[model samples]
Target: MKYSTVLSLTAVITGYVLADTPATCSTTGDNTPIKSGCCPRDPSKRLRRSAREIFARTDSPTCPTPKFYGDSCCTHEFAKPTLDKGTFNLQCGANGVADIVNDAVKVEIVGCDTADDLTKETCILQISSTPAGSITDTHLEISTSAWTSTKYPTKDPASWSYTSYCVKTTGVCQVPLNKIGDGASALCDKKLYIAYHTSTSDGTTSKTCTGDGTLIPGQPGSRWWEYLTLDFTCPKTCDGWCCCEKPVTPPPPPPSTQVCNIGTAFGYADGAKNLNGNPVGPAVCDTANRWGWYFATSETSLSGTLIVGAGGNDLTKGTTVGTWSATITGSDITFKYDLYDDNTNGHFDLSSVHVYASCTAPTTCAPGKFTFKDDTLTGSSDTSYTKTFSVSGGTCSTYYLIFHASVNQQIPSTGTCPTPAQ
Candidate 1:
C-alpha cells in the first residue's frame, strides 16, 4: 500500500506538469512554426485543417487556410465578397418660399458583411439619376446630372452648360440615409429614373435597385433589392427654377426707341457786311457771324446728320465763338452758334445777311437758308451774336455741314466797276 500511494502521488504530479506545459502551434489552429522550443515546432509536422475560411478574422480577403508562425498567419489572398446594396429616387419640392432638392432614396450598402470581419476588400456603389425627357427654358438650366433656376434679365440659365458627373470608381462608404439631419448628395427633377452598381473584390457586380420608375439599361448581380416608386407626392406645377409648384411666367418686354450720336462738326464765315447801312465804313469789315466750321457724318447715302458740335477763334484775336451746339430730337434738329468780337455790329448791315446750311451724310452738305435770331443781339461782352436754326433729317445715318458767306463782292458779274456815276 505504501509503494502504491507513492506511485499514485508521482503519477498525479507528472500529469499536472504535462498539462501546464507552454502551448505549441498545432495544425488545428494557426499551424505555424517557431525557431526552436522544448520539442520540434514546424508547420510540416502539423495536421491538415479543413476550416474552409472566407473573409475571415480581419474581414479582409484571406487564404482559405491561414497559417500562423506561433502567430498563425502568412500569405496574401483575396477571399470572395458578398455585397448587400440599396438605391433610391430623387425627391424635390418647396417649403414656403424656399425650394428643396432631395434623394428619394440612396445607395444602401453593408460593405463588410461578416461579423467581426474587417479585412473585406473595399468597393464602390455608384448611383445615377437622370430626367426622362428634354426640357427648354430661357430662365433656368437643366441637364442629365444638374438643374438650377435663378432669375432672368440677369444671366439666363439657357446658355449655361455642363458635363455628366459619372464614371466614378470611389471606394469610401457609409450607411447614409436622407433622414432629418441626413441629406442627399445629388438631385433629379421631372420624370426621373435611377440605377446602381456594386463592385466586387476583383470586379463589379450587377445593379441593385433602390427606387422604381423605369430602370434603364439595368445592371444585374446575383444579389439585389429594388425599391421602385412606391408612393409619392408628385408636384402639381413647375416653378421658375423648380419642376414643382406654379411655374413662373415672365412678362413681355417693351419696344425699343431710335437713337443717334454726333460724329464731327464745324462752322465758318468769310465775307464783308455793311456797317450803319453804309458800305463806306471801312468797306464793311470782311467776315461773317459764323463760318469755317464743318459737320460731317460717317455715311453719304443717309439724309440725317449726327448732331455735330464746333468752336473757333481767329489767331489775330479779332473774333471768337463760344458755346456752339447742334442737336437733333426726333426729326427736328437745331443749331446754335454765338459769335463774339470787339466790332459788335461794327461791320454788319441790319437786314440782308442770311445763313444757309444743310447736312448730308458720308459726302456732302445740303443748303438750308435762314435768318439769324433777331432777339439774340447784344452789345454786352464785346458784341455777342447768337443764331439758331431748325432743319429736317431725311433717313440718313450720317451727315455733313457746309456753309459760307459771300456778301456782294467786287460784283464782277452785272454791277459796274467802282459804281457807274452815269
Candidate 2:
C-alpha cells in the first residue's frame, strides 16, 4: 500500500485498539461474525469516548504516536533566540510539538564617566542559565558589533569583528561591556551571545542552552573581556633628566707636606796646657782641670752673625795681655779657641784671646767669659786644658772682638816673659 494510505489505516486502527472493550472480528466465508472478543455495545458511545481520550492526551503525551509505519515514537525540537533575529526554529518535530526557546543573554555597560579618563567603569549582563551546568559539548556562538558615533550597526561583523564562544565550562557567556566616551550623538551598544547549542543523546539535535556576557573599558590591547572594570589614560614617557641616573661624586684632593729649613753652629774657647799653663790644644776647651771660655747663642732669623772674645792681664808677664777673635756667618755661628804655654814654667798662663765674633750684627755680642774647669789641673811637668762653645741660629749681624788673659802660679817658676796685649 501507498505510504499515505497506510498512515490513514493505522490511525483508524490505533483509535479503536485503545478502547476498553475489544471488537468482534468479521469472517468472509463463514457468513457469521467471529466472537473471539466482545464487540462495542454502542458504536456512538465508544467513538465519543475515543475522541475524548485522544483530545486529553494531545498535550506532550508520554510517547508520540507514529504518523507513518517507520515514524519514530520519541522526538525533539530546538530553537534559538537572539537580539537582532528574534526567535526562530532550528529543528522541527514530526508531530505537533511546541517548546519554549530560552531568552537570549544580554550584555550592557553602565556607570561610566567620560570626563575622568582614568576612572573605572562597570557593566553587567544577565545570563539565562549557569554555563557550568551545561554539558561539555555545549557551545555558544557569541559575537559583538559595536557602533561608534561615526559608525552604524548594519556594518558587517568582520569589519570590527570581536567574536567568541562560550564553550568553556566557567564564567558568563555575557561579556563585560564599557565605552570610552558618553553617548553624545550616538549610543555605544553591543549585542552579545547571539546563538548557542548543546549536544544531545542523538548527536544530531542540540540541547537547550542560553548565555550572557559583559564588556568593560580597558587599556588598549589588554585582556579586557575578563575584567568587569578598567582604567584608561595616556601612557607615561620619560625624557631629559627624568630617566634613571646616578649623581656623580668628585674624588678627594691629594695630601700636602710641611716644609722647613734647619741649620746649626757651635763655638768654643781652648784652655789646654801641657807642662805649663798655656793655650795649647784644639780650639775646643776641656771642661775639667783648666781655664777655658764657653759661649752660646741662638736666633730664629734666616740670617745672622755672632762674636765673642776674652782678655786678661798676665801675672807671669806684668802689663802684658792679648785677645782672640771668632766669627760666624749665615743663620748659624760657631767658634773655638785654644791656649798653649810656650815656656816650660810651672805656672798656668793665658795670652791674647779673642773668644768669638759675629759678621751679621756687630752691635749684638754673645755672652763671653773665662771660667776654670771644676776639677783641678795638676801635672808635675805637664798639664792640659780645653774650652768649647757654640751658637745655633741668628739673624744677619756683625761680631765684635773681646778677650782676656790670666795666669795661675801654684809653684813659683820665675821668668821674665814679654806680655802680649791687644
Off by over 4 Å in 1: 1-293, 298-323, 341-389, 403-422
User: Runs in model 2 with CA error above 4 Å?
Assistant: 1-97, 101-126, 130-133, 137-167, 179-193, 196-422
In terms of TM-score, how similar is model 2 to the real structure? Answer: 0.18
* Tens digit of per-residue lDDT, candidate 2, span 18-41: 222212122121322221111122
Error of 1 at 364 (Å): 10
Candidate 1 lDDT trough over 10 residues, lowest sum: 4-13
User: Alpha-carbon error at 319 in model 1, in Å?
Assistant: 4.3
